[model samples]
Target: MGIVVDLNGKREPQPSLEALTRLVAADLKAVNELIVRRMHSPVALIPQLAGHIVAAGGKRLRPVLTLAASRLCGYTGTRHIALAACVEFIHTATLLHDDVVDRSELRRGLASANAVWGNKTSVLVGDFLFARSFELMVEDGSLEVLAILSRASSVIAEGEVAQLVTANDTETGETAYMDVIKAKTAQLFAAACQIGAIVADRPAVEKEALESYGMNLGIAFQLIDDVLDYSAKQAKLGKTVGDDFREGKITLPVILAFRRGSEAERAFWRRTLEDLDQKETDFDKAVGLMGRYQSLEDTIERARHYGAIARDALGIFADGAEKDALIELIDFSIHRAY
Candidate 1:
């Protein structure tokens, strides 16, 4: 049985991305080869730094979505392979830039590119990857693909800027946070999935369905990520628990906790997050407060809601392994925090 009994004696489904990865293994391999080839540069540091993060054990989820979505649409051509590589380059570029912006030392349990090769190098390499992604798009000769990816790129930048504006502000509401993640994270996901249909020359309805599925899944994924930041499981996932809290990131957990707490608890949040006067013990206390208010649980509940929508969005597709794997992906996305 792929089910586990937790401490609460509840049956939990253990879902993995293996099904999707196996289904698209050949295309994924081609995408990987293309990535390696494109990442090469005469400048030694570009490849060195870019390859470091690219090979840092990070699950290529975005590109995998591209492959799976394309397959789901019955696309038999070689177009998706390069497009998948392009999606990965965009995602990888974001990770490099994010690490620099967050001043992060660790990425996927390894030293971050910025931490290893300075911020300037990381940013430049990120730019190089972005350029490579656009090059791939242009080479594909699809104006629609180019437009979708370029728009996603711009939206992702805007989302990053929005998050920066909201960071350290405890008063950042759920609506604002949703906007940030949707723009920053979900937009790329939407573009990736939608491109699959576009390449397949599917109808607008199928394209819209995929876009909806990707957007909802992206939101749920980010929500779980927020929950994981305060979870013990975070270390296992290669991130330091409470990095978000330490950086004064106003995630959903913190937002819920702050909104639901008493005056004293709100004051603690203000002092720690807004004032940035955190004590060493504050992280544990923050987690305790989140537990007290059931903020983490509620956040997971929110993810489930989005996951449901994502699953439903796929209802228009035929019943098959591709659809099953995509649906299970929603389960994996929501349950990974456990």
Candidate 2:
């Protein structure tokens, strides 16, 4: 997210943690400003759709993590800005394509770029953003960074395809679900942090630790996201609840509930998947079944476990405020409201 930490050398209310977060804040803002400026394009339509999606806004968490990882690795250079922007561009492009694939009307509390610009324009602009991201990466001129990010992109695409194929299948279990989340979410998180260390010339051990941290954090983040889709309020959630079900996308909580549910609950799921326009009562019935199955609590515990694993990996780093901040980030992902 556009980090709002104060970088000034002022006495802050939060005491010892302020200064550490402030350093991250300065670096985060610089990276964000650079990405915004570099997002311009000569082709009016391309820039138009790209700008709409970029300005639609997100937490910018991936790029922020990249910058934070660079600072944590003791990198003292401006190149991290371009690299951060590259991560964000790749992320945004994926969101654009995703909205089209999901046929989503809303994102980040606003109209999705595809909803506003049409799928054809949205897809083309997304491709343009992807190409532009590669150009930025090439400018950084690190084969290590290139290799890490390119492979992540490939894996994420594969995950998207796999998820699409398995979307409405009740047979999809935890193993299949984990594969989808790891590819779709964790790949980028791992690459963002790993490449940050790579660009900073950190040792392999530290780099691997950061990659492990990112992967677990990503899994926890996406699992929580899926949980919230079924459990959160509509206004607070920004999107409709039961979206995964409505879209025929089987996520972790639903899968868990279906696996543990009664025969009647299974029949309800069949109807929901086969008929997208199932009654509101059916949605309530499914929600109640999920509760009956304790799927929500199970999902939360799973997310908490992954967050713990992520924090444990962070411990491999030498003691520093950055390491503590990383730990706080894992906690935040587990406890976040939105």
Candidate 3:
């Protein structure tokens, strides 16, 4: 029931992002074309590197949200096409920057841009993408759209800063961590969905509903990401099992486990995470502690709670393929962690 059917016409346990993409296939094609067109520059490396990452596989979820939201609002114009491209540019820029900041060696199971071209090139290219995103926003010619996206860009930066401040603190509370995810990750999602309503000239209530759906969905998405880092296979998760642990990134499972563990467990987290004094065995120990506290499962349950909110936010809309796809996407996002 998660999806209609795959190309092979078999039942799928959940709706694939590919199925969602097919729902707005033509618009996604235009968005891809615009992505390549806008990334063009006289500087060869700018386009080359940008193309490499853009062509690298991604769900294009943010842009897809914009496109689907427009359709859900019953808009038929092509304006959403360019604006969808804008959302993508913003997302790509953030990925380029995140890989650099995390000092990551891999992305999407490939060498990270920074790893291949050095941190300077990666950072500059990220800046270039950000500038390109602004240009697309300007071209869209909607002051409201521009304002929402611009504020989202600033909020994303603030979220990154907040994460840096809270990193490896071992005392990062659920509230503070939620704030970081809301700002850094959810803000763009909220903006992306809201722009659809804006372009469709929908009223404030619908705009708020889509925004809420995006925000809650994003929280569910990131929470699952945190859980999968420890629980999912590398092939499934597309990153090392302990990347967060190695980087000392404080996420929900770690937050919950640390708070719920014994005194010795707290000292252990301090030794490995706060002190960055880790050995190969440390990851195993950390995993054991997380399991002992039921942290991973608990985190996924929290994600389900947010997923329910995301679904409810869309209740104002009648049942249809778009709404069903979005609801399925929420389930997909949460279950991907398992």
Candidate 4:
């Protein structure tokens, strides 16, 4: 989760939080410089489209995680900044393509890139960003970072394909859901933290521990995202409620609801999912049914489980403000805006 902690008086120090905010503030400038320089290049319309989306404000969670993890490992270097920017570039690229595929209208309270630019341009620009991210990673010159990010990007691509194939399939169980979330969300989180360790040249044990922490944190973060899709206000979410249902993306809450609902509820799930285009009332009824059954609570409990595991993973690190901040981050992911 990309959380900004208010570290006020009479409390333990928070090195990770402090470092993360500073890194974001600083490296965001670097990324913007790179974007503008590239925009002036004679690339295709796709690169131009990508530049627009990349400049749009987001929490910059992946890059922040990279910088924080490196600081927690006692790193003192400028390369971490460039590496963090690389992570954000890759993440932004993924979003441009994802919005195009999902046919989404809104993201981060703004019109989606694909909404303004055509799908072809969005996808092509996303590819340019991906290539640019690789160039930045190579500049960092850490073989481990390169390997970790490369594998993670591959896993993310596979996860998106899996999601498209499994959407609206009620037979999708918890195991399948876990696989999808781990690949799509957790992979990048794990890579973000692992790269931090690589940049710091930390021992193998500590690096692996941070990777575990990030993977659990990523899973928990996505779990909350899934819950919010059904529960949050449209303004807060920057998107419509039941948007996933309308798109036939059967997330954890919907899966739980399907398993626990009565026969009529089961039939309702089928009607909404199997039918090509469902009415607005159909989506509304599905939301009402899930609310009645407390399916959101079930999903939240699952998120809490992963959050606890992430916090526990931090125990391997020596007690410091950085570790304290990491623990609080887990809490933020669990209790966030639900």
Q: What is the C-alpha lDDT of each candidate?
A: 0.93, 0.82, 0.89, 0.78
Candidate 4 residue pairs in clash (backbone atoms < 3 Å): none
Give the RMSD in angstroms, all C-alphas superposed, for model 1. 1.6
Q: Who wins the TM-score comparison?
A: 1
In model 3, the runs with Cα more than 4 Å from the true position are: 1-12
How far in Å is the alpha carbon of 132 misplaced in model 3? 1.0
Arrange candidates by lDDT, descending: 1, 3, 2, 4
Better of 2 and 4 by TM-score: 2
Question: Residue by residue across 306-330, what tens digits does model 2's lDDT show?
Answer: 9988888878677787777777777
lDDT of 1 by residue, 137-203 (tens): 9999999999999999999999999999999999999999999999989998899899899999999
Backbone clashes in model 2: 1
Error of 1 at 230 (Å): 0.4
Candidate 3 least-lDDT 10 residues: 231-240
Clashes of each: 0, 1, 0, 0
**On a 0 to 1 TM-score scale, where does candidate 3 land against the true structure?**
0.95
Each prediction's TM-score versus the true structure: 0.97, 0.91, 0.95, 0.89
Worst 10 residues of 2 by lDDT: 11-20
lDDT of 1: 0.93
Cα lDDT of model 4 by residue, 1-338, tens digit: 24334546444333233444653566556655655564454755655676567656766778778878887888877777777777877788889889988998877777888898778878877887788788877887878788898888899999999988887788788889999999999989988988878888889988888899999999998988888777755446455676688778878888889999999888888878856468768877887887888888888898889888888877878888667667777776666534
